[model samples]
Target: MLGLVGVDVDGTLVGTDNRVREDVWAAIERGRAAGMHFAICTGRPAVGNALEYARRLDPDGWHVFQNGASIVHARTGESLSAAFPEEALPGLLNMAHERGWLLELYTDTDMAVTQPGDVARRHADLLGIPYRPQPPEALEGTVVRVQWVVPREDEGTVTATPHPGLDLHPAGSPVMRDVMFISVTRAGVNKGSALGRIAQRYGFGMDRVMMVGDGENDVTALRAVGHPVAMGNADAPAREAARYQVGHVDQGGLIGAVDLALGL
Candidate 1:
């Protein structure tokens, strides 16, 4: 029997605009009723501000947040947090200031984002999370990860911040713009590790789980599960990782993937 299900938020399950449809929620409810353990394995940080639908997507299952930097029970909020190496924080901070790009820092309980622009404010309003404008010094005390939100059409120009020991890479859901988000975390802190840990903790075999997504950060989770599905709108990397590629989210790709996974 399929014991667990791991689905990404942006592309595979929801549409490209970051909203969850009623039909998809029905699918989640049905999956739960079918004795399948459900989890939202996303790069979104628990400490940072989230979207409105995000709150609804959560509160029902395990949250693989911060791109797998933290794993927590959504209802109880009990979690295991892994932070970046202390020795590397200084360089990361310096790089952020040099680039003048907004940096979002994530801890299990605390969050701070610098250079709050209009886009950030809009996102904050949608999620109803109060944005506390804090400086770099606020980043002290065991930061699990950092993220960069680049402006539209400027993703490619955002040069990589050299962190030999830290892992820095781009992240987002199917709904997000292409290549606009960059996530930074410790090498071992990611969705793949989180998925593996969640499966082992719940006594589910790796082969019984499904990981579906359409972004680069999702590559880890996609490779970890028995079936990795790429949305029809998935970028090249996501398509490469997935064993099966479904139609676009707006076209009811997730419903199709569910049927296909179970041979329904």
Candidate 2:
């Protein structure tokens, strides 16, 4: 039987409205009732709506966030997160400032942005948080991830830039399709590696875990899972990595994935 289900946020859970569909929530409840574990796996930081969702999913279980830079227990506030490579921070900060880019730095729960404008405001809304932009130096806790929130047209340039000791994962939200979010973590931290850690903590192999997702960043976890389920709207990389396909997120595709997990 599948022991756990890891779900992506933007495309797999919520669509453009940025709210979890009622049917998806209902299905998750049913899965929980049947003793199935559910986890929110995403590029989002562990704060605001994301934190709330993690607690709601399974308060006692582990959830992966920040593209796997964070793995926290919803109820206990305990973390099995990878720390950001501090040595790489100065160069990234300098580069973003020089380029006038919208760069964000995040700890396990708090975040700060270099550019707080329309994009930052919209992101704050999506995160279900207030629009208070704090500087990176003022943020409390161990920093884990940094992201570049730029227009879709700038994705290529951002990814092409070289940053030693950092790994970049580019992703998009259905709600902000015109924008690209480039997440940077330590050299090897990602959803796949983090999922493995979560599985080990649970005393199970990754084959017993099912991952549902629909984006480029989801590709790593998708490829690592025994049952890789993709939403209908999944990007090419995600679809290619997944072994199963569900309906679109807007149409409550998560229900199908949950049902599959329960039966498997």
Candidate 3:
């Protein structure tokens, strides 16, 4: 039996419209009634709309945000775990500037980009939050993670470069197929590590956990759980990483995945 369930936002939980279907919410409520906990694990920042989704799903539950760079309580806003490696910021910023890449730096309070672009504007619009056009040095302090949104064609080149203290993972966005995400975090930070922490806190092992996702960044968390589910619309890498595959997000895949997890 599964004790905890972790779900990715964006493509996995909600569709391009960013709305969670009624049936999916119903399934989550059913899972909660059966004593199962749910966590909103995403590569999104911990602040803004991400927290709103987390509270809506499980107000008292843990939230794994920024691709596991931050783990916090949804309702109380207490930090269970957080990582902000300032040392990696300089190198990441330098690379972004040198490569002329549009980079967004995320803090607990705000998200800023060195220069605004279509991707940054879309992100801000999606979160319904305002972003500042600040240089990397100006947006120092309390940086949780950095992301570079590049054209899909440039993904290979951007990811090929290496930074000393940063770990890079390239992921695709369901809303923007032409774009690719280069997520940069502290060397050891990833969703898998954060899921392990959540399991430890609740006294459950990976074998008792179920996770659902549909993107490249979600691969680590999917592999960390016993019941790994990939949405039918997921990228090839994500589908290959999962133990089971369900319908697309538009077809209520989250609902199906949860039902399968609970053996309902």
Candidate 4:
């Protein structure tokens, strides 16, 4: 049986409606009862709805947030987060300013945006937080990740830009499919790396880990685990990386994953 399970948030756990089904919750309870640990691995920062979900999933376990830059213990509030390469900031800041794109910066528990408007408001809603725009410099903790919130059409432009010493993981929420959230972290810091750390911390080999996800950012994690399950609605890259596939999130696909984890 798998010793650990890492799941993605938006496209894999919750659907476009942004809600977890009762059946999904019940499956998690069953998995926990069987002694399998679950972890939230996502590109989102650890705050607001995301933080709540982490605690709810495994109150005392560690979660991978900010595309793996922020690894926090939901119960103890201990962080094993990575630091943002400070040198990459000026170039990114300049890119955003030059293009007038909505850029966001994140610490372990807070986030700030450079441009705010309808996009920001919708993003805030998606994040299950109040719409509050603050300068990036105003965030109180160590900044670990940066993100570009742009229209789907602008995705290529953002990705094409040169960002040395950094890595970009582009993801889309079903809630706002036309908007791409491009998460930037220090080079080689991604969901796969973080999941590896989480497994090592628990003394589980990568072969003993299972990961379920449905987005571009999830590819790393899918490749990191022995049993990599992709959602029915998963992106092409995710599907290509996975060893197994489940139903859609809206259809309680996690229930199948939970059963698989428990060897049912």
TM-score of each: 0.87, 0.97, 0.94, 0.98
List of clashing residue pairs for candidate 4: none
Give the clash total for candidate 2: 0
- Candidate 1 on 52-151: residue-level lDDT in tens? 2334554555667778887877667777778667787677667667887777777776667777667566545433467666665766566888877777
Per-residue lDDT of candidate 2, residues 173-200 (tens digit):
8888779999999988999888888888
Between 1 and 3, whose TM-score is larger?
3
Q: List the residue pairs that clash in candidate 2.
A: none
Candidate of highest TM-score: 4
lDDT for 35 (candidate 4): 91
Candidate 3 residue spans exceeding 4 A from truth? none
Give the alpha carbon lDDT tens digit for every residue of 1-264 in model 3: 789999998888878777789889999999988889899988887777778888988888887988888788887777755556776777777777798888888776566787676777787766657755666667655777788888999998888877677778677766777888788888888888898898888899999998899988888998899989999999888999999999999889999888997893
Per-residue CA lDDT of candidate 4, range 59-126, in tens?
A: 99999999999999999999999999988888888888899999999889878899979998898888
- By descending TM-score, how would the candidates be arranged? 4, 2, 3, 1
Q: Give candidate 3's error at residue 104 in angstroms.
A: 1.3
Off by over 4 Å in 2: none
**Model 4 residue 22 distance off true place after TM-score fit, in angstroms:** 0.6
**Ranking of candidates on lDDT, top first:** 4, 2, 3, 1
TM-score of 3: 0.94
- Alpha-carbon local distance difference test for all models: 0.71, 0.91, 0.82, 0.91
Kindly state the number of residue pairs that clash in model 4. Answer: 0
